[model samples]
Target: MSERVMSGSVDGLITLEAADALWADLTADSAVPTASGAFTCSPAHARMGYVLLGGHAVTTVSASGGQWSVLEVEVRRAAAALNSVGMDRRDLVRIGPFRGAPRLECDEETPLRWRQRIAGELQEPGGPGLAARRAAGRPYHLAGIDWRQMLVEQTRDRTQRTWWLPRAVVRLLDAAEHAETQWVQTTRTRQAGAAAAGAPAPRPYNEELRGQLYSVLSRKPGTARKVAGWACAVCRTAPAAVLDHCHEHGYVRAPLCQSCNTQERPDHLYSNDIRVANHYTRLFHTDTDDWLRHWHRCPGCRARTTLPLPHLAAWTAHIACRSLRPTHRAPRGRKPCGVLRVSWTGSQNTPRSCLITVAVDCCPSGEHRVLAQVSYREAAERFRVWLAETAPAVAAAAGPDRLDGLPAQLRPVIADTDGEGLALF
Candidate 1:
């Protein structure tokens, strides 16, 4: 390999000279021949243990959109080359424009396509989705005709600190290589390898969220023009209002609403459980018949057995069913009762009969309670409250003006009814 070390900064960003040089050195080696007759590149270490190579290619016209057709052929050919060397497209961390421009949208789709494929292939492992990870802090790119990438091992542990890896070394290695595309022999001799196996590409959750978020987005002040242009053509909404990426879990969750900044679960129960429940009932109420059609299923069992539930007889009975459950032992907050319990006795003459009891005081005044059930509106209200407490940043971002500039497709999910709260789904 050549002894030249690539390094330095152009403006403030660390230049990738070493990575560029390494690409040239490695490609020159007979061991790593440039297979494609059109593509060219240089290699460098973009980050510690993260290698990068820069290259470009030309494409002949095809039936599909011109730009898209080139991207498909180039990426597929690149994937084939990488596979020959025991690496694959999944190893490609990012691809960005370097020299000649290929297409504008190609830069965005390259990373997205790679991520979608990786998510589908590694779906079973269940880590953070590539898009969310990149959104949080992962850097990947593809800029026009110039394709630049930082490759890393899939299973490598990243828990250790990266301070020891000098930025200069990575930059020095990235600057050296430059070449033209050429075809080489198929690197993968094994026909049964996993890399060759292909499946339908996975859909991006962020893209889907962008489309559904507009209902809320339209409400933003600046989005009015965008909405008018769309001809009211948008649909779909996420189950949660503020969509923040969860790095550990890899999916976005409801963070908060732009309007109320409420959490999904209400803390009002702490101040006055009965009062909050009552207030919720008055705001958006529902009855037994309403539940029979709408919300009767036990979220726990996924079963529609509300008819057999003896706890429906009284508010205390229903509360008892939720209280007595062992998992309900943890108190959400101060309440009239610490928990609820349900017990049953069966007889041949009668079907199973059950009773519900509150583990703590029902009320100090001993006032009789009325016949009422937990309303879906109440549940949604609590969700708003829960989101308020847990994701305050999201709550702050829910103002009417904050969403003004976003595209109609990127709006939030707004609720339909008055005081109905934000509809996430």
Candidate 2:
């Protein structure tokens, strides 16, 4: 990746010759692809290409690596937008954050192009250029390893630069290897089998690929509902697959595909990092831990949450004694906590307009289900104390940082900076 090529080598006129110079395009190497489906583009071949995603044209310029580079860029852009890195903080679209927060985003922008032409290429198995498309229309990703997703998490964690990346990547591969027995796979299979035997799967779940991922604004449950009555919220060609809900809160979000179900479960972190962090930043977790205290003055539980997949609700309690607070019993020993599902509703803001249901489930079950949440500025204030305490340590964790890498043009337009380094709440 460090190798440099001449400007003429990158231009379209000399591209073929350049491709041959950097990569063994004429040889067998050109035919082979890396584990991630990266091909042997000639080192001299700086890539400029476009791919269609969800019916939209995605064009980007990659320095060395071909198509793979483009995908990596997308993941970073997503995280950069989420963290508001060199971007408007107002543009960030945060749905919610738990093990099951559905989506996160910011105003999209045309991704930046690599200023220098480097030496890396990724192509399909069909080979490079026209030949690849002739064989397979879409690019391939390693099974179970969503590289773009892994990178989105990597990009968010500015705290650990290159140090943790290898471990994260290795965990992703390990997960792929062991995916067959995992709950994400097995549970889907079990549910699918039940449906095949004539369970009431409703409409959305009946259609579409059995296991696709999804996101939506509403976190309402989507089961037993007639699909024909309404269209399931989806961003892909696939229709709704099934309902999505937070197992902890017992609140349904939307009808989701198999793909979305897997994303909702950050418990994948306990067995495998998969390199995918939660929707919140590392700083967010740190803040929640130090604050967000329980009303009864029990353990915060926030600190109990783990990372690289974090912001997951930690086990909480109203009192020090778990014996008095048993969870509700369910079929599986793991399913029930002998806790109660005590809930009621009331207004938060306008009379009867902004209704808020506060459930005081003192069951010591880790899931703290609050129906209403505070405004952004109010929530942001909650973190200010923590941010101030750690600002010195964060700033002093010295070395080349994410801010230093941004192009100067991006700083003013997208990045908002203050005296305390690159502050993206």
**Top-scoring candidate (TM-score):** 2
- For residue 112, give model 1's deviation from the true position in Å: 2.2
What TM-score goes with each of the models?
A: 0.18, 0.22
Q: Residue-wise lDDT of candidate 1 within 1-425, one digit each (tens)?
A: 34442232222222233323433344443222332212121111121112222233323222223211122333334334433432223212121111221111221212213223333333335332443244422322221111222223233276421111112212112221111101100112123245656622222223333312323443455432222122111112211123322111122222222111221112111111311223223212333232221111111111212222221222333332334423222357444342232222331113223222223323344433332333333333343353345444433444334443333332222222211111111
Candidate 2: tens digits of C-alpha lDDT, residues 1-425: 11332343333322322322322222223111222222222211124343222112223355554422333333223223222212222222111111223322211221211101100112224322333344442432232122222221222356531111123333333333333223233454477777787643334323332112222322235422333232343333333444543221222334544343343333222221111233223223443332222100111111111111112221111111223333566666533233222211221112233221222233446665443333323322333333335443432322223233222221111121211110111
Instruction: Report the lDDT of model 1 for residue 228.
Output: 19
Q: For candidate 1, give the lDDT of residue 55.
A: 33
What's the lDDT for candidate 1? 0.26
Q: In candidate 2, which residue ranges exceed 4 Å CA deviation? A: 1-37, 40-167, 170-253, 257-263, 271-425
Local lDDT at 333 for model 2? 57
Model 2 gets an lDDT of 0.27
